[model samples]
Target: MSKNNKISALSEKDGVNKPEILSSQVAKHIQAFRKKEILATELIEKIIAGDKVALSRAITLIESTNNNHLEKANAVINGCLPFANKSVRIGITGVPGVGKSTFIEAFGKHLTGLGKKVAVLAIDPSSTLSHGSILGDKTRMEELVKDENAFIRPSASGESLGGVARKTREAIILCEACGFDTIIIETVGVGQSETAVHSMVDFFLLLKIAGAGDELQGIKRGIMEMADAVVINKADGDNIQKAKMAKVEFNRALHFFPPKSSGWQPKVTTCSAVTTDGIAAVYDLILEYISHTTTSGYFDAKREEQNQYWMLETINEQLKNSFYNHPEIIKQLELVKQQVLNHEISPFSGAQLLLEAFKKKT
Candidate 1:
């Protein structure tokens, strides 16, 4: 047989385990990313110069769990920071059947038609059993996925609450560095994750549909309250009248909420992606909001607030990891759990003991 196969057979004959050999295809990619060969600073420069491949690789680096890759990723992000926060960040969320993908495809096309560069960072829910993402929603935006002026990335919601989305917020900075003017952060919209998306975006758009009946419309009021604007999708043909009525209802509903921090009233509008009607109105509304907020200085203030929030979030995350991953904490965690469960120690006492153990690591 072949030399490698013969060697394997000989190893088996000798009752020895053969060493794992890297596949040639995998070796090609491995060789391409050899350590220190391509500096992260070089990648950052290429990304700032609008190199698509470099941006993609930089994002991959950020998403990597490898310690070296993490260092490189942070370096690249820090380098890109000076050029970031230039783009308008929009957050979109809706029920599963609210036609979010279709709306984004049509809306993205509209923006690109106006000569705007767009980037869509969508969060996909991970499968609990497999711990993998089911990335079917992003594919639904086929046109946006193919647009040369657009970059679409689907990240798994695998990190802490809003953690993946926070990474997405970082990705927005990268996209802005690459000269993308518009950044849309789309959430899975199937869980409490909408709060995470709302916290990061400059403007939050809540997508809704008509004819779902009152008290059972599938969207929570807290979500509605969190929105800066509500857009009813699929407003075509038979649904046009229903959508118009829904818009009126939403406007009335929004009137009851307290004034927004931005001093801008939330709007309700109807749009039909299938017919491309009202898409321009939605875009125009975004511009209006941006102009109004910029004039009022709310835009800059909001971004600064987001930065402050992220700083605290990063601190909390790091502290938790440090506490939990401490060797003493890791060793005693099970014992504390058993003590609390068996009533040998109170829950607070058990926690304090663990914290004491974790403090010793310092």
Candidate 2:
């Protein structure tokens, strides 16, 4: 069936007229956004305006696969951009039970108490595999989420690696547009591949447990090397000395590696996110790094580089989607897969045939 026919048939099966229904839904969202009734801009605007509800909804819209909602969602984001603050973007990762959520809640509350608008976006990797997210961070962040100045969003990874959600980059933009002065991205800490979060965030923070004698083994060199700051958590009570010792080891280890970006030294610090001790110092360290980088013009340059990376990623995603969506290409995929599996042809040759078939369809 033709694309239009397929859409029509799908719409019919769902008991609705496809084109008209989609158009109406899109129009309704647009109107709701503009009329101040729905406040599509306010969702993110509230986030920037220090409204938590707006922030949550804005994230939900961005993560939605509803094709009709995308255009207007993009529009709302664009409109909110001007009012948004150029906030500090921090990526936080650590092993499970390292009190990541607790640390964020305490840390977020600390920042907001200092009159900073904090936006928390948690990347829930478990959600991707299970197709359901507990949104545990928001629940764990009880006080912070309730604060009018704080916005908390928990997103499923959706087949992305290192617990980084696919729409996270766009979500960051929306959070920024909403005037969130501080944006924190929390990724599930499992593999060494947490570098994906490092690519987009300005500051990469690796949180580790105190007394994990084999600290080096816990965090891979690749991720440790990318870190802007290494934080030792659970620094209260008996763990305090261990945390301090871990800091010393990390600091020494960092000395052997060259700086990640020019003119900025990645520091190692200790904090008990549970007790809120040393959390403020962690924030201060980030500010110090940002100040030094901005003074050296490295901040602006890094953002430009990140923009280029996003452009490439967007192009790659679109091409993959378009190729797989083509009628002829879809029909040819199984045959190519079998041929490649059976070693009847080289993978490259199979790819070439698929490309040729796609070109013919066009």
Candidate 3:
């Protein structure tokens, strides 16, 4: 058959259809399982049926930038809200050579051995600049990656703040929905701004190296203020004493910062990701933080605050997109830029004019 005939035949088989509804009401209904309007058992069955394509599609729905997808995503999150609180969210960050992947591999193995399921979502900042990610963490975490109780997802950060990916927060929700007890977000440990990860996770951990003296350069007040615990990697072998020294420095530094949301002092420890020494201590510290916060009601409060923050962020993102998509605003933006460049007005004035034009249109 000719190409036109083939297309016609397929179109006839499918019948005529209207453009898709941006709000995706059908998707919202599918996500209503969390409200008891749908069955949780059936949801779990769908997730665990080894349907890789379905899982990927579900993740895309949750990560979507479209306003309609946002509503559907919220419905899905609400449905899983009750079952989601059981998991512990931990944020782990460190410099390039601090062995974050190795530590997570060993730590995850330890957790699974204790009959717990672990989920690791690592965000590689380099992916944004290079448009490629090493994704080496999965290879380094060979054992954990293969374990049935473990799920490792390496995502491209793509210009996101704090070397954290955009969909990480949503991915955490999905992992909780799937019944994972531990969710670990690994971020590229650049410096101060990395605290964005702290806002999302329950426990915020900072990984350091022994005697990197670069600690003085990277350990700003902002990072220390958010950290719940600081771990010095490569503590085994000859690096042990140096790691101990680094831990002391970090401990002293922590004294100047205020307490974290959990109202507990962030502890400092040294560990060898290679030998897995002190990994259990790190896990123990996380549990202690969780216990303290939960008992004090801070855990619930923090989650509430996080939700509010997410809502505000969503609103800002949507407004920015809407402004750029507005035809009148786009036309005025070019004129405004030209005006500014010709020194006819300051950039701020040009922006004001654009805003005025936009408001008039709406």
Q: How many steric overlaps are in each model, in order?
A: 0, 4, 1
Give the TM-score ranking, best first. 1, 2, 3
Tens digits of per-residue lDDT for model 3, 1-362: 78755664335465678888756787787678434322333443454553333344556666666766666666666665565667899998877888889989999999999999888988876554566767677888999989988888787776667567777777787777677789899988887336678878988888889777755653576676777898999998889888888887887888877656468888898888899899999999888888898899999999999989978876886778788878998778888899899999999998888788878888
In model 3, how large is the Cα lDDT of residue 321? 76
* All candidates: CA RMSD (Å): 6.3, 10.6, 10.0
- What's the TM-score of each model vs. the native? 0.87, 0.82, 0.80
In candidate 1, stretches whose alpha carbon ends up further than 4 angstroms from where it belongs are 1-37, 162-166, 214-221
Candidate 2 has a TM-score of 0.82
lDDT of each: 0.83, 0.80, 0.78
Ranking by lDDT: 1, 2, 3
Residue lDDT tens for model 1, 68-151: 566778889999999888888999998788888888889999999999999888888776668688777557888788888998
Error of 3 at 141 (Å): 2.2
lDDT of the structure predicted as candidate 1: 0.83
What's the true lDDT of residue 294 in model 3?
88
User: Which candidate achieves the best lDDT against the true structure?
Assistant: 1
Candidate 2 backbone collisions, by pair? 43-54, 46-51, 48-178, 84-179
Residue 28's lDDT within candidate 1 is 84
Ten contiguous residues with the weakest lDDT in model 3: 35-44
